[model samples]
Every structure is written in structure tokens, then in C-alpha cells.
Target: MRTVGVEEELLLVDAESGRPLSVAARTLQYAAEAAEPAEDAGDASIAASGEFAPDEVPGGSIEHELQQQQIETDTVPHTDMAALGEGVRAWRDQAITAARRAGARVIASGTSPLPVEAAIVGKPRYLQMVEHFGLTTTEQLTGACHVHVSVESDDEGVGVIDRIRGWLPVLLALSANSPFWQGEDTKYASFRSQAIMRWPTAGPTERFDTAESYHSLVSAMIASGVIFDKGMIYFDARLSHHYPTVEIRVADVCADAADTVLIAALCRGLVDTAAAEWRAGEEPLALSVAMLRVMSWQAGRFGIEGNLIDPQTLAARPAREIVADLVDHIRPALRENGDEELVERQIAQILERGNGAMRQRTMLEKTGQLSDVVADLATATAGLEG
Candidate 1:
């Protein structure tokens, strides 16, 4: 089985007011301190107060993000779905604890519900981004859930990316979490997707026939000076620069750990299915980039509430039907990995209870307040509510 990992970016907000807070630096400091050895009495006391011990959680990490209003957590790669789920929850707890110590609360929201003037983290690369991109950098405070699945080689990774392009929009629709942005309802299931698409190189890419072609395209893009580096090659799915894996960057940061795990499981299933197809000498779907972009837009607009473009027919269909097809398409892979039952249950739950976007909208409709939406999201993020 291919090992899978997840990286979730969470929004930090004022606990009482439910407004975005710029305390990521302080929260990271607290996390670093908690990870230190408890050599002194005071340190032991702090440890007793529920701060996470570094050794207790292996291969997971909490880190700062480009924006100061959010933090990102990376789960250790795992072949077992249960272990991957536990890693996600543990990291979320670590982030929540650190945010509390910093006088903030962490919520798994793709965009802030309240109005916010995002502060860019004062890193050299980030500073350069702001200088070059101006408003695109200044206004980009969105969060996403990036999943990495291990691949045998770069050729296999590129093959997976190519074969999985059409199905990527379905994942986006399933994990759409951003409904409101800057205190007003954006009326889109995932406004974060819209926000992210503002970047020149931040959407779906054309299929590369081989790994060399993929690398050559990336190198040419970098040499053109349009982007800063290979890191900016923000395709919906691509080969990871540092890892022997394919990174899928389509989904929003889901508020529930179960939802994140489901996405990761489905991603791994897609990679497995794609690799098998490649091995069997199957041809990838020759969808054009323009069509793929339209599919993505539809997913980001309606989520699971309305319709999505069917990758097979290129026709709009009910979201539930499309999602069902996705499950069927990847059923063999899921079953082989011992995740079929869990994925089916989670998909049913998401469809019935609603995804993060629907839940956010439902809260606002029930409470008539966006603050309540944020509060609900915070509770969901902390795993304190069902």
C-alpha cells in the first residue's frame, strides 16, 4: 500500500470575538517550547498542563504559514487509515493547544468568516512574494488540505497526476469549506478556491507525457521568471519536490478530522488506481485545460449541494451521482488498501450531514450570525462537537 500523508492549514481566531488573529508566531513559539525537553520543575508543570510531548507524537509537525492568521500541520505518512486518522487528530490537538496558549483558537476554515487584514509572515521568500505579486500575496490568506501519497518513481508520479486530472474536481467539491470571506457570504462553496486561482500558476496543468516533460515544463516556467521557483508550480496535482510522492492540492481544509482523513484515503486510492492503469498501458483522459478549469469552477461554486461536471461524459450531473461514480471508480484500490468500508461510511456521512461548506451555511442560517459560524467551526476543529 502507498503511504499517505496530509497537511492542513487552520485559521487562528480570537476565541471570544471569532475574528481572525495574527498570533501564529506566538503560537509557533509555544509549540516549540512545548516540544523541548522538560528538564526543570516548571517545564514538568507545563507538560502536566496538557502540552504535547514531542516524543509522544512521531513524524507529525506544526509549522507557520505564509499568513500570520493561520498555522499548518503535517501528519506523518502512514499506510494504515486508522493510524493516519489518529495522526491528523493528534496534530489538530497540538495546534489547538498551542493556539490557546497564544490567546487564540484554531479553526479548520479555508477563509476567515470575519473581516481581516492579513499580515504576511516576515520571511525572506514571503517578503519577496509580496513585493512581486502585491495584492495577490497580500490578499491570499486562504487555507487548503494538501495530501501526499507515496509513488514508486517520478515516472509513476507523473502518470498518476495525468490519469487523475479529471477526478480532481470531485475531491474539490467534496471538501469545499470556505463559504464566507471578509464578513460577507461569498455565495460560493469554496471562495478559497477562487482566491487561490488568482495566482498565475495556481490551477490545473496540461498533461505531461513523461516525467522528463513534467520537469522540463517546470524548469521552463521558472526560467521564464513568471514564478519564483518550482514551489510555485501549484497544479491541482503534481509531483512533490522533496518527496517521492504525488501531492494533490485541490481540497479545502476540512473542519472535521474524519473529512480530512477521507480525502487522504480517496487521494491514495486515486494514486493507486492511476498507477495500475499506467502499468496496464491505459491512456489518460485527454481533457483540455480549459475544460478542467470549468470543472473546477463548478466544484468550487456548488460543492456537493448542486451539480458537478462528470469526468467521463463532460456533462453536468448531480453532485451525489458524481461522487458515487468516483467511489466506484476507485473501489478496487480502496478495497485493496483496507479503506473501502471507511470511505463509504464517510462519504455517506458527508452527503447526509453536509460537507464543511454546507455546515457553515447551515450554521449561519440557524444562528443568523457569522460569528456563530466561526464558533461552530472552532468547536468542530477542536473535535469538541459532533
Candidate 2:
């Protein structure tokens, strides 16, 4: 089985007011301290307050983001879905505890519901990005859930990327969580997807038939002075710089742990299916980049609440139908990995309860307040509220 991992970027909000808080540095510091053995009484108190015991899962890390109002949590790659779910929950709990120590609450919302003056982190790379990108960097406080699935070789990875392009919008629709942005209902399910497209390099890419073509394109983009480095090659799906895996970067950071895991499982299935197809000498769908962008826009605009572009037919269809098509396309791989039952169950739950966007809007309808939405997100993020 190919190991899969998840990285979620989460918002830090004031526990009472639900406003975004610039305390990521402090929160990360507390997390680091909690991971180390206590050297003194104060250190012991800090470690004790973390509330979570370290797990045997390796490669898990907590890191600061470009903006001080968010932190990112990474799960170690795992071949088992149950173990992967545990790692996600454990890391989320650890982040919550550390954020509490820093006078903030961790939230799983993709964007803050209330107005926020996002503070840029003081790291040299971040500062340089701010200087180069200006408002694009400052205004980008969006969070996303990225899933990495291991592949045997870069050629296979690129082939998988080429074949998986058409179905990515379905993943985005299922994971759409950012409904409101800067105190207003944006009338879109995933405003974060819209916001991130501001980056020049962020969006769909044309098919790269080989590993050589993929690397050459990335190097050309960087050399053109549009982006700073390979890290900025923000294609919806790309080969990972640090791992022998293909990273799918289209989904929002889901508020529910189950939904996050479901996305990861689906991503792994997609990669595996694509790789198998490539090995069988199948040609990828010749979808144009423009059409893929349109499909992605439709998914972001309505999420599962409206029609989505079908990958097979290239026509508008109900979101449920498209999602079903996605499942059927990857069913074989999912069964091989023992994730068929889990994926089906979770997908049904999401469709019925609605994605995070629907849940957030429901909270607003109940309380008529965005702060309450944030509060509910925090509760859901900590796995306290269903």
C-alpha cells in the first residue's frame, strides 16, 4: 500500500471573540517545548499543560505559517486509514492545547469569518515574499488541506498528475469549507480557493507527459521571475519537493476530522488509480487547462450545493452525481487499499450533513452571528462538537 499523509493549515482565533489572533509563533514555541523532555519546573508545567502524549507516529511536525494567525500540522505517512485518522486527531489536539497556552483557540475554518488584519511572520523568507508580492502576501490568510500520497518514481508521479486533473474539482467541492470571508458571506462555498488564485503560479497546469517536462516547466516558471522557487509552484497537484509523493493541493482544510481523512483516502485512491492506468499504457484525458479552471471555479462557487462539471462528460451535472462518478472511478484502488467502506460512509455523511461551508452557514442561520460560526468551528476542530 502507498503511504498517505495530510497537512492542514488551521486558523488561530481568540477563544471568546472569534477574531483571528497573531500568536502562531508563541503557539509553535509551546508545541516545541511540549515535545521535549522538561528540564525545569516551568518547563514541566508547560509540558504538562499540553495534555497529549507523544505517539510513535514519525514525521509529524507543527510549523508556523506565512501569516501569524495560522499554524500548520503535518501527519506522518501511514498505510492504514485508522492510524492516519489517529495521527490527524492527535496533532489537532496537540495544536489546540498549545494554542490555549498561547491565549488563542485553534479553528479549522479556511478563512476568518470576521474582519482580520493579518500579520505577516517575521521570518526572512516570509518577509521577502511580502516585499515581492505585497498585498497578495498580506491578504492571503487562507488555509488549505494538502494530502501527499507516495509514488514509486517521478515518471509515475507526473503521469498520475496528468491523469488526475479532470477529477480534482470534485475533491475541492467535497472539502469546501470557507464560506464567509472578512465579515461577509461571499456567496461562495470556498472563498479560500478564489483567494489563493491571486498568486500568479496558483492554478491548473497543462499536461506534462514526463518527469523531465515537469521539472523543466517548474524551472522555467521560476526563471521567468514570476515565482521565487519550486515551493511556489502551486499547481492543484504537483510532485512534492521533499518527498517521493504527489501532493494534491486543491481541498480546503475540512472542519471535521472524518472529512479530512476521507479526502486523504480519496486522494490516495486517485493517485493509485492513475498510476495503474499509466502502467497499462492509457492516455490521459485531453482536457484543456481553461476547462479545468472553469470546473474548479464552479466547484468553489457552489461546493456541493449546486451543479458541478462532470469530468467524464464535460457537462454540468449535480454535485452528487459527479461525486459518485469520482468514487466509482477510484473504487478499485480504494478496495485494494481497504478504504472502500470508509470512503463511501464518510462521503455519504458529508453529502447529507453538507460540507464545512454548509455547516458554517447553518450555524450563522441559527445564531445570526459570525462569531458563533467561529466558535462552532473551534469546537468542531477540537472534535468536541460533531
Query: What is the overall TM-score of model 1 with all chains considered together?
Result: 0.94
The alpha-carbon deviation from the true structure for residue 309 of candidate 1, after best TM-score superposition, in angstroms, is: 0.9
Residue-wise C-alpha lDDT for candidate 1, range 1-386, written one tens digit per residue: 89988889999999999998999989888887776454532211223222345345323667778899988888767899898888788778878888999999999988998899969999999999999999999999998999999999999999999999999999999999999988889989999999999898888988897999999999999998989898898889989887788999999999999999999999999999999999898999989999999999999999999999999899999999999999999999999999999999999999999999999999999999888999999999889973
- Per-residue CA lDDT of candidate 2, range 1-386, in tens? 99998999999999889999999989988887777554432212223232334342224777778899998888778899998888888888889989999999998988999999959999899999998999999999998999999999999999999999999999999999998989999999999999999998888889999999999999999999988899898899999887889999999999999899999999999999999999999999989999999999999999999999987779999999999999999999999999999999999999898999999999999999999999999989999963
TM-scores, all candidates, are 0.94, 0.94
Query: What RMSD, rounded to one decimal, does every model reach?
Result: 4.2, 4.2
Candidate 1 residue pairs that clash: none
Question: What is candidate 1's CA lDDT for residue 239?
Answer: 90
Residue 240 lDDT (model 2): 89
Q: Which residue pairs collide, candidate 2? A: none
